[model samples]
Structure formats: structure tokens, C-alpha cells
Target: MTGTRSVRPGIRFAAAGFILAVLLSAPRAEPPPLTLAILPLKLLDTSGEPIDQGPEHARRLAAMARGLAEDLDAGGDYRSLLVTAETLRARCPDERPDCLLAVAREAGASRVFVGVVHKSSTLILQLFARVADARTGRAVLTRDLNFRGDTDEAWRRAGVFLAGQIREAGP
Candidate 1:
């Protein structure tokens, strides 16, 4: 039975010491998250119907966009810069790549996000989002999703789902 104690105390102590040293020497600080600028969502009517160009629709879309930015920020993967609809309109005015780049540069953001919500019918809506890199002027992430029901709650849920997907996909 005494022969079973082949492992020595000195070796165990050395192993523990090595592990402790490694743990103590490892870097504890993480790099800062990439700054992401969230632009206002574009509301479009794709059903060939005369769309209501009212302020209510614009406000709702802006609210949803803000919620998405907040969700992404809460995920702790990105530093979200949520721009107001009015500011975004005054700055970009369109969802062109060049405009997005300008906004990113002005905001000092590495990444910029733009989204469009197209209503095809009373109960069908399509949401499309794209994130572009300011340095490269290329899209880094893009997502498209459809939601049923013409209610604010449904739109909010879709926004939440999109944010979760973006976060899950990583920065």
C-alpha cells in the first residue's frame, strides 16, 4: 500500500506554484468594444400603395430603432451610438453607402448600421439591416427578417430579435 504513493509532495507543490504564477501573470483587461453608430430606420411602402407620410410612422420607427440600439448596447459587445431620427435625416438623408460612411466618420464610429422596414401589406412587413465598416467602406453584417401582424408590439419584437441575432453573431 505504501508503494502506491509514487506521486511526491514536491511535484504537487511545483505544479500548484506554476498554475498560480500563470493565473497572476495573465492579462485581466479586455480591449474596448468597437463603436457602432445606429442610424434611424427607413420606412418604406413596397405594396405600391400610397403610403402615409405622417409623423406617427416615423416616430414609431425611430422608437424601434432606439430599442434595437439599446439592446445591442446592453449586450456589452458594442458601444452603441443611437442617433435620433431627425439628426440622422439631417445628416445622412439617405441609406447610401457613402452617406453611411460620412455619418460614421462624423460620429467617430468604426461601424455603422442602417435599417429599412418595408411594409408589403397590412399584415406583412420586411426588415432589413446592414452594418458597414467605416475604415473599409464595406458591409460587415447584414440581416433580413419578416414579421407578421401590423401592430407596434410585433415590430418591437422583431427589433429585439434582430438585436439578439446581431449580438449572438459577435462584433
Candidate 2:
């Protein structure tokens, strides 16, 4: 009986060692982070009238762009390409799809985020954002949000909500 008990312990020890060795010998791989380029949001007046959005609104738009890039980078799953609006414009002078694709290639980003903020009415603002494959220019995910007020805080809140939605959608 004692011999039988000793053999059982030895067998368990050998099995555990083998399992550990196999696990250690197996290759471990980590997926590469998604390289993302967040572009500035374009502004449009949906009412077909030229609305003068003052310099303050311009600053707010810039802030939202930076906020989007920061949020995506801090998520730890994406490598955000730090591309300024000027740099992007320099790379692609026109708003053509091909120009945008060329800029994405220049930035070395696998994915690109294009967005727009539209003023539909005096009290209504709409945001449209999309993540597209840089190589194919196909949209992977798109989100649109409407909110009241045109204040900086309102825009910031919208940005936060959009970022959260994008993170949950895994792009």
C-alpha cells in the first residue's frame, strides 16, 4: 500500500512538470496595436446658409480633435498617429477620398477616423464620425449623434460620448 501511494505522488509530480514544460515551451504572441489616425472634424451648415462660426468655435473644434486622439491613445489598444490638422492638409491639399487615403498612408496608419460637425439649426448640432480602413477606405464603424447647445462644454461632452462608443465597438 505504501509503495502504491509513493508511485501515485510520483505520477502526479511528473504530470505537473510536463504540463508546465509544455506551457513554457509554447510560443507566446501579442497582437500588434491598431495604428489610428484621428482627423479634425469638418464643419458645415446644414441649413444651406453660410453661418459664421467665430474663432471660439474654431478653437473648440481643435480641442475636440485633440481630445479624440488622446482618448484613443490612452485606451491602450490603439497606437494613435499624432497628425496635426496642418500636416494633414499639407499631405492632402484637397478633400478628395484619394487625398485622404494618401495622407493615411503618409501617417503610417492602418485606420483613419473622419468626422464632421454640422449645425442644422439655431439650437441643434449633429456629429458624424466614422472609422475607415486606410488601405481600402471602407468604413468599419460609424456613429452619429445630435445634441443641443453649441458651447465648448457641449462639444466636449459629445466627444467623450463618441469616444466611449468607439471603444465599446472595438475600433
Candidate 3:
């Protein structure tokens, strides 16, 4: 009978309050960066003999990381590049493992990716994919994931896992 639809004042007020709360609590998203450089990888295999400083180990890890970076680009709308360990060591002969960061900075990358390979019969893999500020070496984000498989397939699963993370993270 009233001019407006008949509803209790408290009910109307509660509905309005809920609407306001939802508006305030909704998530906001931003686009990811446009370019990323995938730096090289190191093998940390523990066994009767070490795999470090060997072409077989180092080249495989580097190729796998590059593959990952390319896969990430598919979902991220980003540019992917390989920053080779040879080029890095050429610039800084006294290269510690972390010196790869400097090369990424040189490549004009906003984000740098790094990984370490751990090999075993079951292939316990620990991959450190960190996005860092190229200049200061400050880590912006990191994904630490593990995989158990034959060594090569472990690389593929880990790559898929990383690509999903990059996509979900919005670049």
C-alpha cells in the first residue's frame, strides 16, 4: 500500500550493507610484465661422482629452463629469451652461481628465472624459480616445487607446473 515496495527498514539496510561490503572486498588484478629472461640452471647431483661442470648435465638443465620460459610466455603474453651461461661466464669470469642475475640485468629483463637440478634414481627435483629485480637482486616472487619421476619426464612435469604458476600469478 505504501509508495515503495513494503520491506522492513532493517532488511533494506542489511541488503545495502552487504552490497557495500562485497564491493569493497572484491579482488583487483593487474596485468603481468611483458618480458622475462630465463637464465641458466645448475645441477646439484649427489652421488659417487658429481655432475657439475659437465656439458651433459649443464646443457640439459639450461635447455629445460629455456623450455619452461617459452612455455610461460604462451600464457603470460610475455617475451621469453635464453640468457646463456657461456655469455654470463664470459662477462664475469669469477662467476659464482648467483652471478647469472647480473647477466639477466644486462639482457634488459624485468624478471629472471633460475633453477637447480637434483638427480637421483627417483629423481628428487628441487626447482627454484624466482622472479627477481634484475638490478638489486631482490626477489619479488618464488616458486619452490618438487617432482619425482624419471629425470627427463621430471623436467617436463616441472615445466608444466611452472607454466601454470606463471599463468595464475598474472605474469
Candidate 4:
């Protein structure tokens, strides 16, 4: 009986060892990427000059916003969803946190990104950006970037830099 009991325990120990080995060698499943809703970039002209709401300026803003989304999506950390201007104006005209969060929830996003370009002059622009939790409207990341020149290249560079910053900051 003692010999039988000893053999049973040895077999159980070997079985456990085999199970542990299999578990340790199995590949882990990575979590799905988080969905992010990126709102249209708002242009606020504080340059004290006449507001240039021309088509060219509007085009640049839209392009910059799209570039940011592409940069972020390229990282594979976030699935970027671009929000249209008409939807933004119609759903969240005031852009309050609650309103934005609602929009994000409606879009099936886990997070929301918002940005504003403050053009101080023909040569200077400031970018204010934030990422917030869609469910709680809590800010996860915020960054302010200052870049010179009003050209398309300058704006594109700024968007790239901001995207890198957000990725590094884990937003």
C-alpha cells in the first residue's frame, strides 16, 4: 500500500510539472488596441489680424488633423476614428467635456482626442491638445506645442511631433 501511494504521488507530481511547462511555453494573447476618436482641429486666430477663414486655411487644418490620426494609428497602439466637422458642430457645438464624451461614446471609442491651433501671428502658432477617457471625461494626457511658420510643412511637423509625444506619454 505504501508503494502504491508513493507511485501515485510521483505520477501526480509529473503531471503537474507537464501542465506547468505547457502553460509557460504557450504564447500570450495581447489585448486589442484601444479605439480613439479624434475630433477636427479647431483654428482660433488670436493673431489680432483679420481672421483668415479661407479655404486654404481650412484645408490645412483638416490635413493636419488627418496627419495626426495617421501618425497615431501607425504606432498600432490606437485605432483612430476621425470625426467630421459637421458632426462636431452639430453634436458638440460648445465642445464641453460632457458633450465630447458623449460623442466619443456614440462613436464607440474608448478615448477622445481634441486639439486647437492658436495662431498668434502669420509666423507663430501654438497647438493645444488633450486626450480624455470617453466614459469619464477624465484627461489622460495634455500637451502644448509651439511651432514657427504658418506653412503646411510647419503644421505637418507639429502634428507629427505631437503624435510622438502622445505615444511616448502613453496616451
Candidate 5:
């Protein structure tokens, strides 16, 4: 009777361990590896036309992509092949990878990111971003990022938001 009572807790613990082991051993899904192309950071004028090329905005976009890659690398979870703003500006539009498959092959990336900037209302600036898979030519993620700033602040916010999205977004 004494041994039976004492073994009950041990049996319970064993059952719990078995449950935990099964849970841990269960198969987990994974995101695939791919290259990401970032288009030039276009700053639309007050008239809603792309007229200004804010150096700061351009730099921010490039930095944002790089930062996202860096953060992912630190965790050792995924890899990002990011192209710089300078390359986008330097290349001809026809030569650039605005399309997914084209972007992936040209930029040597598996995915592509195309973004547009629009000044919404008076206080908010909208950064419309889209992610496309180069292999499948499908949009994986779509997000409208907003920033509160005139010039420098806008890019800064864009950078931060891009980083956050990448962290929250898998692969």
C-alpha cells in the first residue's frame, strides 16, 4: 500500500514527460529561403507625383532592408538577399526587377519588395509595401506603413517599421 501511493506521483510525472516529448517531436513547418529585392524609395510630391528623390528616404529604404537581414541573421533563423538603393537608382527601370521572377533572377533573390510613398492627409505619410515571391510570382505580404515626419523622420520611421515587420514576418 505504501509503495503504490508513492508511485502514483511518479507515474503522473512520467505521463507528463511523455506528453511533452510528443509535443516537442511533432513536425514544425518552415519558411523557405529567398532573395529580396527593394525598389527605389520614391517620394511623391505634394501634387501626388513622384518628383522628389530625398536622399534620406533612399538611404533609409536600403538601410531598412539590410537591418532586417541583420536581425534575422542574429537569430540564425533565415537569410535575406537584399539589394541597395544605390543599385536600384543606378540601374535602368527596364533592367530593374519590379516583377517577381525577373527581380529574383536579376537581383539573385527569391523574393522582391516594391514600395511606394504617398503623403496622406497632412500629418501622416503612407508607405505602401508589397512582397512578392520570385519563384511563384505571388504577393506574400502587403502592408501600408505610415510615418509622422517631414523628411528625415519619415525615412527613420520607415526603417523602424520595416525592421519590425521583418522580425514579425517569418522567412
Candidate 6:
């Protein structure tokens, strides 16, 4: 009887340990990524000089916004969507937080990313970007980058840097 009791306890301990090991080794399911609406980046040229708002500039802006979305989406943290300037203006006339949040909600996004490129001159540009919670109108991430040169490559690199910052700041 004594030997049987000792063996029973050993079996129970082994069974418990095996169950714990299996549970610990099981793959955990990650939660779905949050939906994010990336609004068209606005240009605020404060250079006090006429810089051509030509097709090239427009193309660069569009590409920058698209690249940001793609970069964020690739990180598996956010399901990024694009919202055009016209759409945002039509939906929310004001730039207030509440208005922005309403626009984000309408786009079925839990968060919104907005940015403005401030051009001091043809050689200098300052980019300000922020991510805000649509529900609370609270900013989750904000970053500003100043880069030299007005070339496509410079703008593209700036977007990449901003995206890396956002990824590090996770949703």
C-alpha cells in the first residue's frame, strides 16, 4: 500500500508537469492589427518664396503618403488605409480633434495618421507627423523630421524614417 501511494503521487506530479509543459509551449495567438487611416500629407510652404506646386511636387507627396501606409502595414501592427485631402475636407471642414476623429471613424479606422511638410526653402523641409486615437482623439505617436534637399529620394527617405519611428512607438 505504501509503495502504491508513492507511485500514485509520482504519476500525478508527472502528469501535472507534462500538462504545464504543453501549455507553455503552445503558440500564442496575436491580436488583430488596429485599423489606421493615413490622411494625405499637407504641404505648408512657409518659405515666403514661390515654389512651384507642380505635378512633380504632387506626385512626391502622394508617394510619400502611400509609402508611409505600406511601411506601417508591413510591420503587422496596423492595417493602414489612405484618406485623401478632398475626402477629409468634405467630411470634416475643421481641423479640430473631434472633427478629425469623426472622419477617422467614418473611414472605419480606430486611429488616424496626419502630417504636414513645412518647406522653409527649396533646400530644407520639415515634416511633422502624428498618429491619434479615433475614439479619444489622443495622439499615440508624434514625430518631426528635418531633412535637406527637395529631391524625391530625400522625401522618400524621410517617410521611411517617420515610419520606423511609428513602428518603434507601436499601437
**Residue 151 in candidate 3, Cα distance off native in Å:** 3.0
What number of clashing residue pairs does each candidate have, in the order they appear? 0, 0, 0, 0, 2, 0
Sliding window of 10 residues with minimal summed lDDT for model 3: 46-55
Better of 5 and 6 by TM-score: 6
Q: Tens digits of per-residue lDDT for model 1 on 1-171?
A: 565465666678889999999999999988788788887788887666576655766776987878988898887888888766677578767656787677777888998888888988878999999888877778888999999976779889998999988888788
What TM-score would you give candidate 2 relative to the actual structure?
A: 0.79
Predicted candidate 5 versus true structure: per-residue lDDT over 49-139, tens digit per residue: 3555456556655565566566655655445566654554455555544433564567677666666777654466777877778777678
- Local accuracy by lDDT, each model: 0.82, 0.83, 0.70, 0.89, 0.64, 0.88
Q: Please tell me which predicted candidate would have the highest TM-score against the true structure.
A: 4
Q: Rank the candidates by TM-score, best first.
A: 4, 6, 2, 1, 3, 5
Residue 25, model 4: lDDT of: 95
- Candidate 5's C-alpha runs over 4 A off are 1-33, 47-53, 84-92, 95-100, 120-122, 151-154
- The lowest-lDDT stretch of 10 consecutive residues in candidate 2 is 45-54
TM-score of 5: 0.59
Clashing residue pairs found in predicted model 5? 35-109, 35-110
Better of 3 and 4 by TM-score: 4
lDDT of 3 by residue, 38-118 (tens): 777777765445434366656568668867877876765777778776787787677654676667767877777666666
Which RMSD does model 4 reach against the true structure?
1.7
Clashing pairs in 4: none
lDDT-superior candidate, 3 or 6: 6
Better of 1 and 3 by TM-score: 1
Q: Assess every candidate by TM-score.
A: 0.78, 0.79, 0.68, 0.92, 0.59, 0.87
Quality of model 3 by C-alpha lDDT: 0.70
On residues 1-171, what C-alpha lDDT tens digit does candidate 4 reach at each position?
A: 989998998999999999999999999887777889999888888778675556777898899889988998999888899999899789988878898889988999999999999988989999999999999988899999999998889999999999999889874
lDDT of 3 at 161: 84
lDDT of 5: 0.64
| lDDT of model number 1 | 0.82
